[model samples]
Structure formats: structure tokens, C-alpha cells
Target: MNNPIPPRAKKIPHTLEIHNHVRIDDYFWLNDRENPEVIDYLNQENAYYKAMTAHTESFQKDLFAEMKSRIKEDDSSVPYFYNGYYYITRFEAGKDYPIYARKKGSLEAAEELLFDCNEMAKGHSYFQMSGLSVSEDNQWISFGIDTVSRRQYVIQIKNLVTGEILPYKIENTTAGGTWSADGMYLFYCRKDDKTLRADTIYRHEIGTDPSQDVKVYYEKDDTFDVSVYKSKSKKYIMITSESTLTSEYQYVLASEPTAPFTVFQKRTRELEYSVSHYGNHFYIVTNKDGATNFKLMKTEEGKTEKEYWVDVLPHREEVLLEGIDIFKDFLVVSERSEGLNKIRIMRWDGSVDYYLPFTSETYMAYTTTNLDFDTTILRYAYQSLTTPASVIDFDMITQERIVLKEQEVLGGKFDKNNYIEERIWATARDGVQVPISLVYHKNCKKDGTNPLLQYAYGSYGVNIEPYFSTTRLSLLDRGFIYAIAHIRGGEDLGRKWYEDGKMLKKMNTFTDFIDCSRFLIEEKYTSPVHLYAEGGSAGGLLMGAVINMNPELYYGVIAQVPFVDVVTTMLDDTIPLTTGEYDEWGNPNEKEYYDYMLAYSPYDNVKAQNYPNLYISTGLHDSQVQYWEPAKWLAKLRDLKTDTNFLFLDTNMDAGHGGASGRFEALKEVAKEFAFLFDLEKIKS
Candidate 1:
């Protein structure tokens, strides 16, 4: 086959001036999704991607099948008891969606089907169901569905007793609604039509028209987003308004569905806190009073004020209190120390306090699905780079635990012992130690010839935990090492780590990644010619920035729905998540932030250079990072890049930020990516 000609997007020079600074964007006209020309350009790019990768089609299919074979096609999640029923989400063989069912009182009881998502998703190209909420009475279930993959769901209630779907629908919701104690009313969040931000909270009465749903609260601040949930204690219906650096909560007695909400505390700048209702008090995990690592505090239910809060767990400089789970007899806290997860179990009376035993230094362990507060059993999940995920239930008093289920890798070739997992530290340019968790086949060696795929997402304090991926085994089996770089701009090392990599110090994130790459090469783990980098969304931004700064250091890169046009996206407040993310990536309206962001913005920084082999994918309907960013990026790169290295753009026209919302369907996307890497290394299975 002849070399495919890449799509060259037409450049209609558009000038943008911000803070008295002038910038020229040639492909700005591609932003209009409604324009037929824009769609044509995207289709052309997709066609080019198909043509360029046509030779690898069989390899991609085999890779996808190889990865899919490891997955148990007919599988059910561990049934968890909630309310009066045992709920289970199971996937039938050959089905792309799950079947949600419940049994009354016991696991042996006859199952009652709540949602067969496969049946519901049949008509939609992109479908996702979120915010599944069962009423307190367990007689009704509420769910939100997004057929467009824009994260905007339409909530619908169903009568479990009668097996009838309600006629009313609440549109443009964040998905899922918190039900009143009587199960007569539902509280849900509504998004702004233009920005897609959840800015309003509404209360809907069952059997009533959704159009008449009462507006419970409206967040006037553009920087803040709102969400509603029933307290874990099931006593209060809570509404939380939060920004990147601040949070404020309000509550109404779940019994009083029509009552107005009372503020737990007013929003204070830089004061981040989350509330959970307990017996007579509200337990809070907060960064109050300069507690950068966050501390635990409790306030009387009657006195929901910051002044009334007393320390339950004092702030520890070394430990970051990530979250907490309250129970009738105990309090479970999720903490992170030295970039490792720790789950601490404590009795309410202080009779016992200990962390659950975790053997692996680079494993992830956290509390999960402990809805029944009356029980002594604490349910949690544990997984490592070499271990499959296991959901375990623990007896706090006896210190005994039982593994409910471990993810079954079904191809018969799987063995945890066959892989080696380890944590290594790399020294950054500023002399900081960045942790990297790695996993590879035991046969693989730490030689410069080994191919290493490095991944990281250093943004919004989102820590990418070291966890196992069945699909990743395909890479390991092909003599590749998978590593997770715990770089700054994430909470891996604590809030301070994130703070040091944001705002004026944001460049540390890019430099730290590049430094890690250089360190890996210098240490003989992998040479520049054998190293590959991958990141999605914000991490995609990391990939773009690193390639721009040190393109020669990587052989290839895969950026999925990357937020690369930083300055432009951050400057436009109307874009989804832009306004609320001011604290994450500073508000670019100001000259200082404008200058800092523009300096590293990948699309803005693309110049005449020999770039690495690139594979970029985006969703046309993506709400978070607009599809046009990558489209415009590829166009400019095609024009300016001096290298003959292959650059491919794949756009998922049917999906949004999350490509392909299916069990096995999503693996095809990963297969394409893996194929790109394998093809570059000339390794075909």
C-alpha cells in the first residue's frame, strides 16, 4: 500500500488578544462542530488514520481478542447488601452492558431485575448509565442515562414493585438522584446547558411532572459546582457546592423533603472539607486552619459550624487523610503516606485503632461499599501491579478477613507470580524524588534494550494508584515494562506535592516527567529509542508538554482526549469545567497566568521540530476537552513538524470524553493504541 496522505485542515487565521498580548491561531475555524466543513475535516482525518493503520488491522484484532480472552465474559460483581436487598451487577456472556439485579433480604432469594443495560443501550451508539440510586424503601430505583456520552444524563424512576417505568424524566442532570427518607421525593443536580456544569439542585416529587420540580438551590458562582447526595448515615439529604480550592455544604432532614436546606458552613476561600453524618455529629475531613495534609474534625449535628468543630484526628504532617467511612461501631479512614495507601480502622470508643495490613509497598487499598453502618464488617478492595483486584470483607474486632472475589483472568495463561512489581524513585531536575511503580514479566530485564511504557496523570490532585490491568498483560508478555510515574501536580506525595506543581509552579509537572524519562534512560531501564509515554485527558496534556520539551527522549506517545490547548481552553469560561478549574490551571484572563500557560500550551508551542511518532484520539462530543483542540493541534503539527515520523489522529464520532462505553468495546480502542506501540517496535503477535 502507498503511504496515506494525511488530512491538512484549512487555516483561516484567527487572532486572539488576551491581557494586551496578541496570538495567532490558524486552525481556529475547526472549533465549530455544527459546521459541515469541520465534520468533513474530522472524517478525513479518521479516514487517514484507517488508511495508515490498515496494515495492522489483523494485528489489532488479534491484540483485542488476546486482551478480551483474559476477561471472564460471564461475570458478576460481589453482591453487596444495601437497604433490604443484595445487589449484584453481572455481565452476560457476549453482552456489552451489565444487568443490575437485587434479591430481597438474602442472596438465595429470587432476583428482581432492576436494569438490563444491554437492552436499554441497544438503540444508542454511545450509552452510559450513572448515579444509580435505590430509594430508602427499596420500592423504587432511579437512574440516569446518557446516550450521547456528554456526561449529561436524563434521570428516570422505575417502580420495582410494579415493574413500570415512570413517565417523567429529568434531563441534563449529572445522573443519579438522592431520595428522601419516605422515598416520595428525589433530589438531583442539573447542569448548565451551555457549560455543562452542574450548577443547580432540584427536588422532584414522585408521580409528578419533572417540569414542576422545585429548585432547591442554585450556585451563582461560576467557579463552583453543586451536587446532592443522601448522607451515608441516611439521616440528612446533603447538598455540596465546591470549587477546586473551597467547599461548602448544606443539609435538610431526609424526613422533611419539602424543608429548606440549612448551611453546614459558609464557603471559605481555600478551605476544603467534606462532611459525613454520624450519631450526634458530622465528621469532617478538611484542610482547615492550615492543615495542608487535612485533618479530621467533628461538630455537633445541631451546631454545624466551623467554630464548633473539634479535632477527632489531629493533622499529621506525614499522613494525608484522603477520606473516611463512618459506621455504627467504628470509623474507617483512608490515608496516604509516602505515596502509599493505608486504611485505618478505629472504634468509636477508641478501644482499638490499627491500619489494615497491606504487604505490598506499591499496592492500592481503600474502603469500598460499606453501606450497612450497623455491621462490624468493613469491606475494602486491594490490588497491585502484579495482583488482580480483590474485594475483601474484614471483621474489625476479630481481625479476620475473607476475599469476596478476585478478578478472574480467564485465558488460563494468567499467573500473578509470573510478573514482578516494584517501586523505584527517580531524581527530578529540582532534586525531588519522584516515585515510579513498575510491573513487567519476571523474564524482563532492566536493560536499555527493553521497551518501557510510562504513564502518569499529574493534575487536579488526582493520584494514579498502582493497580493491575488485565489488558496491560499483553504489553508485558511482549517484553514491555509498564510504569506509573508518581509525579507532582498529584496528591501522591500529599497536598503539598500538588501545590508545588500548580499555578506559577506548574512547569514542574512537565519538567519532572521529562526528568523521570531521562533518569530511566540513564539508569538503563530503557533507552530513548525504546521508551513510550501514554496519558489521557490532563495526563494527555503531560504527554504533549513533555514531547514538546524533550521530543527526542521518547520513541512514541499516545494522548487520549488530551487537554493540550491549555491557554485557549482555560481562558474561555464558557467551556465545560473551565471556570471551576481556575485553581487547577490558573485563570488565564490575568497576564501572569496567561504568560505561564501560553509558555507550555502544547498547541501554542508546536513549532518546526522533529517530533516523536504520535497517536492522538478524541471524541467529537467530548464535553471536558473539546474535540477541536486535537483537530486544530494535528493540523498545525502537520504543517510545522519537520520529522517524517508518523502522526495519526483517530476521532470517535459517536462517543464523548470517555470513548466507547462498553465492556469489550472499549478494549478495541486500547488495542489500536497497543498496536501503534507494537508496530513501532516491529513486534507483531
Candidate 2:
């Protein structure tokens, strides 16, 4: 058998390779609990992971440290950690930069201090403390800090109007900011340590004492989080639970926080309303009628439980309804028909609202907000063949649109006109139609010689749409097409698309993605020899399985932060994301589930086979997908395979899933992925 791995990585995404890295070893966790190697690896990293958790326990010390550094008096260059106008100043060597807040008014250049990456990295796994999420109003900033143990950190806040730095108040070790309608009540839920699993929701007065004026919601025995939202009249408060895939929600009196009552409720299911809001009345769409279909309904009497469901948009056998929002009297939703997503707007009165004619073949909203009762501002990104990623603002009432601050908040020399986007359809093995979004240079010839790259994550009912990226432009300029395989494992074509690509139907996702690559070849969109595939986490599993099953189809493959060890990990409930994944990937404890998962568990099925130019990157700090899985799989490959496929590991000792702490750091990580792809150069046919 003459199997060989090609030089795809070096030629495509443009990154130099580190070769012949290690002498193969026996599987690291093969000995299970008695493994000495496991102890060595654990002792080394566990010490670091525990640092953040331990420091958080002593709350005062960590808070005191940040207060001293960023919250000190006379530090005007830092952001004013205020409620509305909150932003931070980064005084760099050659430039003075400002990190924008969600709203404007809270802090000034002097009042807020910038977070020190090095200082904050202490006591955390790189994977754990890697994200920063600001509240909708932009009054408070919440970030994950210290990974030794996972605890969401409460950063400083500034009064939007005054430059006064509010006293640092602890929300919860695990609880996050659940800002109120007025932004005064920052509610959060804490897992009662005694129970360890179940948590209790608590409302914090933000700037007040940690003890007084605290309101507690349901004290359940399951792990949970709170999502706070206000109705159009500001009379209702919606609090959704943080649970596994199917979490139930409870609505309470917003003005009467202490009121012991739930207004209306809907438990999360395959097709039920995951979330809802008010226009003049309650509007919701759920897969409740059937997993493959959605029944849209409106409500006026919320407290009364009634089956007053209306069918605004019936189930399209192919179109997937991604999400919906109530701006004013209108309801806006983004739908994925075939594989292209377009934003559609409708009215509560059952009349056609102004529909923003599907302009960008690839359109979707990231998040939305209401400016007033009649007008709303939708913040999202829009792109097509002629567009790069730019944040846009749409007036829901006036139907006016504006481009917000363009990206490159960090500054870069990016050419916008070099690349364009397009939609293409691929036929699946089961005669299903799949759509892929492609981005390449306008001047590039379609002679099957251009390097082509494809990315897909068909899991967890998420819809992968198009967005702008400068890191990817390097490949387009070099005659490469960047694509997103809108395959199964997502609601790309509605519930049926997801149902067909999940659990026992998971192989459909892999084959659909493969079929997409084949369609590209059949249509001469690109050459198979130049084709490359990549994905992280669940998508990484898809990439791993396809390459192993059909190595000849691809020239190169990159699986970063991959979840390839399916059977072993999913069955062990201890892994961070496993239990919640059972709804998506069937629980392997039962014989049926065990067989289904074993059917696709890539790590366990590694035979003496040739692989695509392979690059697997894992982070020791990855609390989600443990580093040991990929490390062990590569070891098996080293021992079993005689092919020239390359393996590379750049474990971030500090990052969580996404890797990197700041925006610049995050870009660097993304740049690394692009570098690997650029070097591989999807060899044109």
C-alpha cells in the first residue's frame, strides 16, 4: 500500500511546518486511573488551574489587586467603568487606543484602568479565562478570569454620566451580570456550594451592599443561570434558566422583583420556543409542533396558559428558521433557506412589515436592541462577494441603515476589495441539497487550480452564516476560496436538517460536507488535490472522521480544539460539556447510544491508515476538550502510520476554548490557523 501525505499545509495557508516531532508512545490514558503519565500531566496543569479558583475563594485579595491597579484614583486614561458610557483606554507605545463600551457616558479616559493580561492570567487555564462579554446597555463589563477553577469575574464599572468608579461588588463565583431594565439591578445566580450542582438565582443591587436588597429566585437542584429581559411595556421580566440543551424558563414581575409568581413559561425542546419577547403582545416560534417544523404564535394574556399558537410561517421542508426578535410593532427573524441566510422583517398585526430584500446572500444579526418603543437599532454584520465584515445598524421603525465603526479596532492594512462572496449548492449522498458560501478573489480564474478551503460545524442546532474576516483575506489574494459548508448538525434547512445530521444521523453531516467538496470538483469550482478541510470542537470531529474514512478526497486537514474522543469522553459525565451534549449526541451509557457513538468515535477507530496532511492543536488549558485526547490520538498515528502527514501542537497554557485573552491575542491565534491554511494552498486542479 503506497499511501502518502502531500505538502498541502506548506503550500496553502502559508505556514512553515515543524516536522518529525516525537517518538511514538503507548496511549497516555490506556492504563486509566492507575496511569503514572496521567498523574504527571495532571499535577503539572492542575496546579495552574487551581490558582484562579483559589484566588477567587479569597475574593477580597483578587478584587483588591484589580482595584489597586486599574481602579486607583487619578487613572483618567483608563475607561470610566460606568453603567452606559463604559470604555477602557489602552495607552500603547505609538498609539492611544480606546476599547468601546456598549453605550456611551459612564467612564472617561482617566477613571477606568485597562486590564493587565499578565496579571489576570494568574491562577487560570488559558481556555477558561479567554472571553469578555459586555452587557447590552454597556454599563458593566463581565470577563472570565483565573482558570485554576472556573469563575466569571466582575470587572470594574463606571457611572455613565459621572466619572465615579463604582465600588467593586461580587456578583457570584459562577453567576454573571443579569442587568435589569434600568441597569441598576445586576442580577446573577450562584450554585450553592453545598449542593455543588443546583444553583440559586440572586438579584444584586450592583452599587449597593453585597447583603441588602438581594432578591432570590427559585432554588433548584440542577445547575442553572438567569437571563433577564424586559417586555415592551417594561411590566414583565423574563428570566431564562442556564441548563443543558433543554432548560425551562420562568417570568417574574420586573417592577415587583419580590413578587412570587411566573407570568408565562416555555420549556426548551427541539422545536419549542427557546426564547420569547413582546411587541404589543407576546410573539414566539417553537419546534413544538414537530422537530422538523415550527409553529409561530402570538399571546396577549401571558399569565394564563393557553394553546393560542398561530402559524405565521409554516415548516418549510428545507428552510431553517435561525432566530427571531421583536423590535417595536414588528418581528424580525433571520432564516436559512437552502444554505443562504437572509434577514426578514414582519409585523405583529399579521401584515407584511418592511422586508429588507435579501441583499447579502449571506445575512444574519449577531444581537439586537430597541432604541425606543417605535424605533429599534439592530446591531449585526452583513457581507457578500463584494463586502468585507462591517458592523451595521438598522433602524427598525424608519427602515434606515448605517454602518457602525468598521473593524480593525486594533489597526491593520487590509484591502477590502480583494475578495468576494457567493453561494453554491452541493448534492448530498442521500439526494439532499446542501449550500456552501465561497469567498475568493474576483480576478482568480476558475480553472480548478486555486487553493480551496472549506469549514463546517454541523452540531447543536447552530446555523453557520457569513461574516467578514481580514485574517482570511491572505488566502483569497493567493488564489484560494474560503467556504463554509452549511451541512447537517445545524438548523441550516430547519429541524429536518438538524434531525438528519445529529445522533444516529450524524454521518449525514460528514457525507454532506464531503459531497460539497465533490460538487466543487464536479463543477470545476476547484480541484480535489488542492482541497483542504478544517473545523474546531464538534466540527473538528467531523473533519477527523471524513479524512480517516476518505483520505484521498482531501490534500490537507486541520482540527483545532477538536472533540474526536467521542465514546470515551461522552460516557464519562465528568467532562465539562459532555452531559449537555447527550441531547445532541445520544448518551453512550445505553447499548444503543454506545453503538451509535462508537460508530463515529474517531480516536478509537484509528487503523493503520494514511491521513491528509494533518495538524491537530490542543490546549492544556482546554476545560472543554481535554488535551489528552488529541495527544493520545496523534501518538497512535505516529506508531501506526507510515505516511508523511505532519502533526503540530501549540497548546495555550492559559486559553479556554477560543484561546487568547485580549482582542489582539485572539487575532494572533486566528492568524495561526490562517497561516496553517495559507501554507497548505488548496492546490488548484
Which candidate tops lDDT? 1
Clashes (backbone N, CA, C under 3 Å), per candidate, total: 0, 64
- Each prediction's Cα lDDT score? 0.93, 0.60
Error of 2 at 313 (Å): 5.5
Candidate 2 lDDT, 1-685, residue by residue in tens: 3323221111112121112222122463432424565545444333432332232333333222322232122222322223344454343331112233232453323443434454444544342332343444555544434443223343345454454557765533453444555566655545433222324566667667766746566644233444554454555666666543444556665666666647355453432465465644566665655635565666665533436656666766666666676656667776766556667777667666655655665644454433344556665565554455455777766778787644341233345555567787888888888988888888877788877888999987777777665545556756778889889888777777777888888889888988998988777767877888989888888987897778788888888888887876776666565655677788776768777777777776777877777767666556667776765666566556667655554556555556665434454555455555544653221
TM-score of 2: 0.76
* lDDT for position 562 in model 2: 85
Number of the top TM-score candidate: 1
What lDDT tens digits, residue by residue, belong to model 1 across residues 1-685?
Answer: 5787787888799999978889999998998999999999999999999988898999999999999999998999999998788999999999999999999899989988899999999879988998999998888889999999899999999998899999878999999799999999999999999999999999999999998999999999999999999888899999999999999999999999899899999999999999998888899999999999999999998898899999999999989999999889999999999999999989989999998888886999988898998999999999999999999999999999999999999889989899999999999977999999999899987779999999999999999999999999999999999989999999999999999989989999999899888988998889999999999999999999999899999999999999999998988888998999889988888888999999999999999999999999999999989999888888999999999998989999999999999989999999999999999999978
Stretches of candidate 2 off by over 4 Å are: 1-175, 179-185, 191-200, 205-233, 242-247, 261-263, 266-271, 275-280, 301-319, 347-352, 360-367, 376-380, 395-398, 406-417, 677-685
Error of 1 at 349 (Å): 1.5
